[model samples]
Target chain A: MTLLQRLAGSARREPRGTLRVVDPNPLNWLYITYNTVEEPVRVTRRGKVRPAAMSSYRWRGSRTMEIRVRPGGRFADGTSLDACSVHRSFTEQTRWHSPHPPGTHFNIDPRTRAEVVDERTVRLHLPEPDGLVLGKLRATHVMSERFWRDLGFGYARDETGEGHW
Target chain B: MIDAPGPWASGPFTLVEGRSIISTEPVVTDGEDRTWLQTEDRSPTVRLRANPHYWDRVRGPRVREVEFRNDVDRRRALDLVCDTVGEVDIVTEVPHREAERVRRSRHARLVAVDSVRALAGAIDRGVDGLPLDDVRARRALNLAVDRSALVRDLFGGHARPLAGLTPPTPLTALHRAPGRLRPYPYDPSRAARLWQAAGGGSRPLRLAAMTDWEAVAHAVAAQWHTVLGLAVEVRILRSDEEQREARRRQAAKEPRDWDVLLLEQGSQSADVPPLELHRAFVGRSGEFRAGPVDPKFERLFDHLRSRRSQLWQVLAANRLDRYVTDQALALFLVAPRVLYAVNERVDFQPYATTFELADTSVRRGHWSLR
Candidate 1:
């Protein structure tokens, strides 16, 4: 299995495993590992961005993409994950400065709204047609709207200091 | 958010930050019997301990705990890691001189990858009294240094001499099609002529660089002093805030202190090359420090924004690369290869660049001790 698959599987099977790693401090670990809860449209490995939570996504034209979420997804909070939640997560991402650097956004600022076509379908709207949309999309992670509204913009830590969706 | 302290983490492991250092602990308790603990020693040494909570998927960091030491001195670091008592598992940032020795040694494994960033110097045309206001002087400065020799001696032949902004990597080479690119040749006599024409004979030049890159400052200072017979002194910027302030001062067309500044630009794949250019050269906040602006280059970037074809986009980027080089906006320098050393006992896979691992590569948790 790929390291990511193993990590995601580990997160599912056991929320705690002592896996020691040398920290490179390159990208945010939150977005990089453990994709069982909130997953990005794609994850990069060895320079290639591979699809993950998103089954298939394509640009409608230059500035918009029709995104299809994998069926039967659930947030760790036991809340059903849907297209509206994905749209809300990304819209929240652009509002405040994300932990990611400015150039990381590639000027693909999602404004106005991402149309929730259906329960499993989302249409992302970009400011303009950006050539870098694919790479930037790889960095955008979905967050639970319930968590974002109740606890705060970031992940909530349980009593044990464990992060919850 | 720009002001957010940390990104909401959703991973198998969670970071435990200490007063001075940060450590990671697994969040998912699989009833595994293994643990991972780390403590920092203020400087470079990081002590790793096997937690009883750690569940090992891979075998053996045989020693109960391993110490990782960081030393700028390559030979000394190698010696410590090779020692039985020290038991240093890894050495970060080894110097180029010890690459051969580290490669041959059985104690430590040498880890070197081409640095995604390049070290280059930019001349400030906005400096009130500096002769660099003339494009010829900037061109003269670019021609004076022998980048090939600098790469050979300073980098131990482990870097590629960049003529333009983009290094010819598998991804960046797309922006550097053959025949369209030209780097300033090392020609001191012609440089001398340009200097004389620009009336810059014996003028004192101040070069500013990052404090972390003192070695780069000295190397550039030495090259300019020896090659062009110009008096050059290097100044180190204490922090990023200071660097930004200086860039802002230059962007606002305010008088600047130094004539040349050593700057670094990195490309981590995707369509980032154009964005980098837009940040450094085109916008109102663009910080090249050179007061001059080119309308033609700005037009090219606008063209870059509208184009969708990979072939056409790369062609436009290459044109921008050529335009920037010909203007002597920044003298292209060699992209140094990143170097690391790990003990022979450990199983590790190092990455080409650090930023690439932020989302995908597993640098931790999966590595096993042999």
Candidate 2:
């Protein structure tokens, strides 16, 4: 199949083959296989974001959130996407500067602290109550530990070491 | 692949041959210079093969291989898809002028969706020698221009006139009650009266717009000139560098060269959280704001952000929308739709937000090459 796109000069930077989950953020291109949770259980025709990855989430208090991860999820590298890995991913995003693009954040509030509660649960402690955290998390793409070790904070470049991975 | 460790894509498809061009340049931010490496895919075509290890391999990527052509001209691309001979399965961004042709074509169908995008003129209330600082003057300007005419003439009736900063999307429709939020009707006499009372028209209003918006800007300038008898000058920002420079100046609070800047504002998704749009266009540090920050607006926005319940948040957002509209903070124009030309042989369903082809498949009997 052949697809034709008339992209702007700036938009032509990224590969066009990737399936961007129809979301508000144009860069939210986290492939379904790379997600720590399941593909969204349901995305409304109107484009509403529903639970997919984390089975359910609740605000423990004003500043704390408890999220239950869907069990048995794995990264492309074949590593289990358990609660500890989710915590680690959140912590890493807060500690390191994103190499993807300027002005684009990891969507994790830097002031939040991630703690693993159990095998399938993680708790986030935010400095202040943020209602938009869940929406932000939807935009945050989780990468495998191997991805971090190999690519560091920088994007994965092509064979010629040019384009983003 | 030559030597890279991995592309390790977990998506429905994996990159088969990825080629691109890169350029590193220095950009200044906050008085400090930093190196920015930019990459451009100079390759005319990129091929992707279905990933066998994909999570839902059974239901995902029915087509084994997908090829994307990046260098096709917009008009020619539409024509190719509409051709009797199937040149391409799907061609996106069907030009508005050629939409009727695509509609009349038997080989292709036009898919149009109300996108989460809106074009508006950002009024610089703080600019010197401009009377836009007065709310009455701003309201006068908004009332002067005919949004319906712009939608019909410029957009070929593919857009809806905006009543507020946000477009009429499904999410926004929930918040805005009919008749509660009405677009400012074109009233040149009332506009002239308000302009005269506010002591406007002392100097020509300078309008700055990018090349893509040059035509709309000129049309608007002409309207303002004829309606309010206000002298207006339209300046086109021809290059990206020029736009960046203009934005830098706006961010630094330096003397602005233009009184009104025409720009598009919207989320990439069909369902956008109203708070996101507010922060990007109405917040004090908003990227597209040409007007001075209003403390009152910020307070309301902060209140909206603090709400936990979705209903309360939406109510607060509606209040903010009403406040902006009443104050005439920006000249809200039209909500444009995303158009696509898909071949008849392909069963393609267009998403309102992004250009997605993951579920796209050819018709039952059209898979084989003729």
Candidate 3:
């Protein structure tokens, strides 16, 4: 198995993480609050207009990814878009980044384990952490790394080459 | 989807130039003396004199004959070199052991530089070198390493093991590791204390790893579990799936659901900025590299990304050291070199350092046809 498989999952094993299914055609102004499991996802905002606070924005904290069923929708920043949404989003910095130098150690308060109890069954435990951070989850979404490496491509950085290795 | 020709396939050496069958008579130029056959090996072995009609004044190959035996086979290559039948030169990819052996026993010349990724430690090529921020923690971890053991066991001492990556080209300021980046060894006790201080004992770390890195991840996990008594589970992400996750993170076009990724970045080139690393974890990368977040670093990162103000960009990149040191989201292990073994008659330099070997030419006067 390769590093990618370890990050996602080996082919032999089942994948862990939440899964979700959204309507293919979400209505304009669709406010999605799904569980991404992890906190703060990267986003490209609606209507090509750039975000004023572009880099400082956090997907989880605010409206990250917004699309328009109707182009030229009204934006939070009072910008106009085509009848469809534009692509611009906010990015959030992690809590563990240190401002020192390269090769310095930045550590995370890792949440290592979770289990499924029932149909929609899920219980998460992050020992000694503060606050309940809600996130989006999509079971139907996660891809198996092993499946692909075995299938080819996306193996690891070292595994990359011209044609399929 | 890619019918477009690549650099090597389209020019100088065309892909269509390859022979379909070994026995097929090769296409010949008007003034060339050698009539040749394309031997299934893709490379052609020909005995050619100077083309009288050639426009260039340059003399051709030194040797009268040139032989290509498909891909060079190692043992057979060595024997050919040893016997001096059709070979007098050979290059070994394994630097320390094989190069040393060839030099001593086989009497082959040896030149060692970084040739391939080392067996000394695991390399995580992710954008976020965050988790490795704390000099003490990083050093402590390095101290716990058994470099000699890894070198001996995994590579049979063919690699010169070190705590960090050796830049392929001449030293630029970027290649140097600050005094704080020193390595740690296998000290369970120190790891325990560091873990306790870093809140490792306080929570469970969802240890993300790729299948290739599973053994190393488990080893670290075992150390964490045993020494620090920290609860951790090692999760393996497949390769392609991880790439899909990375592409999603990069494009900001898709969603991610992992805690951390054990992966390598595409490049360290300034042109290849560390933005991807920033986005991989803490940024809105589907929370793949989620957080126990740091606001100061985040603020600087924000400034760095937005402050197209030239003076500020340098400050931001410099600040990168800070951001990476504090949180330790992604850890960079080590960078290795590419290893290749060639037949004695094959003359080649460690092709230029860019990692692209397509158009690399062999050193003159060294290569000969068998």
Candidate 4:
């Protein structure tokens, strides 16, 4: 299959199929093909957010959310996806510079921390009570630890001319 | 221009290096070659192959490889898609003017979907000596134009009259109750009466718009001129630089040259939730706001943002939508449908938000290598 874009412009510098997923460019179409993440919630066709990667989630308190990941998920690199990986991905995403506008930055807020409670559970500690936290987590993508080690941050191309995560 | 490599993240198709190529010419190849053809002026084409390690093996990517090409001219893009030989499988956007042509093409099919996008006029209420400062006058402006006629005549019935800032999508319908939130009916007499009550004079309103919105601006100007007997000068911003400068001026509240700015709203993905759409349009720091912020709207928005319950937030959003319409913050126009030209051979399903080909496949017997 072949796709055509009407406009001609420079490709974005942000690595494709990563945590930074706010912009709706053609590159975004490739996000699902390359990255794996337990979206805390998925927006339905009618625009309602329902549980996706996570089997279930609930608010522990005003600023804390306990999420239970669905079992049997794996990254493209063949690594098992669990609570610790989710915590690491969320933490790393917070530290990365976001190219999107502040309002559209859906990654866990920088002040928020991700805590792994068990193998399948992760707790998100937001700085303030947010009604849209689950919706916000939809933009966050989880990559294998090996991906971070190999690609590090930002756009990286090895001698083979392949993009890093 | 870095190419996507394989196996970094988990998608259905990994970026196949070497086999994946970018070229200016329409070269269809499944050979493993490291050919990267790029020219100074032409947009490059990209190709991707399916991932063997894809988790859902049963469903399958189905196709072995996919290619993407960028066409600088939309007309040419449409032409290629409608070609009898099927040079291209799908084209992302078909210009509204050429939608009819695509519809008539035997080799191509026109996929028109309801877009979240809306075309509206941002009134500069802070501009002194204008009746737009008055909410009744603003409402009068919205009421004066015939949105239905605009859709029929201008869009060829390819659009829906916008009742508020957001388009009438299923998501938006959840908040806006029927009859409670409806578009201001076309009533030129009522508009004239309101304008007269607001002490509106013969001051010629200056309307600024981009090249794309020139037609709508002119039609709106004509309507205002005929209905309220108000002369409107439509200034066309031809270049991106000029549009950027106009936006900067609008933001700084400097150079009060234009009383209204005719522009498109929701250029972002159509899948955006109604709450986020509201934040993007009327929030204190909204990107599309061209005039002075309203304190009432600010308070309402702040409340909506602070709420923790989804139900409360939805209700608040409904209230906010109603408030913006009632206050007539902007002249709501039509929600145009997104158009796509797809080759007959491609089994493509258009996404409401973005142009996606991930789930798309070719009909078994119909698709053949050129």
- Listed in order, the DockQ scores are 0.16, 0.15, 0.01, 0.15
Best by TM-score: 2
lDDT of 1 by residue, B1-370 (tens): 1012222322222222211122322211112111111222223433333222222223111223333233324456567555432234455556667677778876666766655556677667666555777778888888888888877877788777876776555566667765557568889899888877888745579988876567767887787777778888778899656866665555455567777777765544434465554336433335453566657776767776566566777787777777778777776777676676666544444444332211211123323321
TM-score of each: 0.71, 0.82, 0.41, 0.80
The best-first sequence of candidates by lDDT reads 2, 4, 1, 3
> Which residue pairs of candidate 4 clash?
A1-B67, A2-B67, A33-B11, A34-B9, A34-B10, A34-B11
Instruction: Give me the runs in candidate 1 sitting further than 4 Å from their true place.
Output: A1-56, A70-82, A97-107, A110-112, A144-165, B1-101, B104-106, B178-182, B238-255, B281-283, B287-293, B345-347, B355-370
User: lDDT by residue for model 2 over B124-205, one digit each (tens)?
Assistant: 8876676788989999999998999988988788888888877887767866663388788999999999999898766899
Q: Which prediction has more favorable DockQ, 1 or 3? A: 1
Ranking, DockQ, top scorer first = 1, 2, 4, 3
* Model 4, span A42-134: residue lDDT tens: 444334466655779988888998989768767666777678777876776665434122233243567887889999999998898776667
Model 2 interface CAPRI class: incorrect
In model 4, which regions exceed 4 Å deviation? A1-52, A96-98, A101-108, A150-165, B1-6, B17-43, B52-62, B248-257, B267-274, B307-309
What's candidate 3's i-RMS value?
Answer: 27.9
lDDT of 1 at B11: 21
Model 4, B1-370: lDDT tens digits are 2234445544444554322212221111112111111222212444555655544433335455655554334566666667654456666656677789988987888878776677888787777777777888998899899999999888878889988776877666756763378888999999999988988855789988888778899999999999998888899999756876675565444565788888775533323344445554555455445566678887877676566776777677677888889988888899888777777766665555544344556664454532
Q: Quick one: best DockQ, which candidate?
A: 1
Q: Rate the local accuracy (lDDT) of all candidates.
A: 0.53, 0.62, 0.31, 0.62
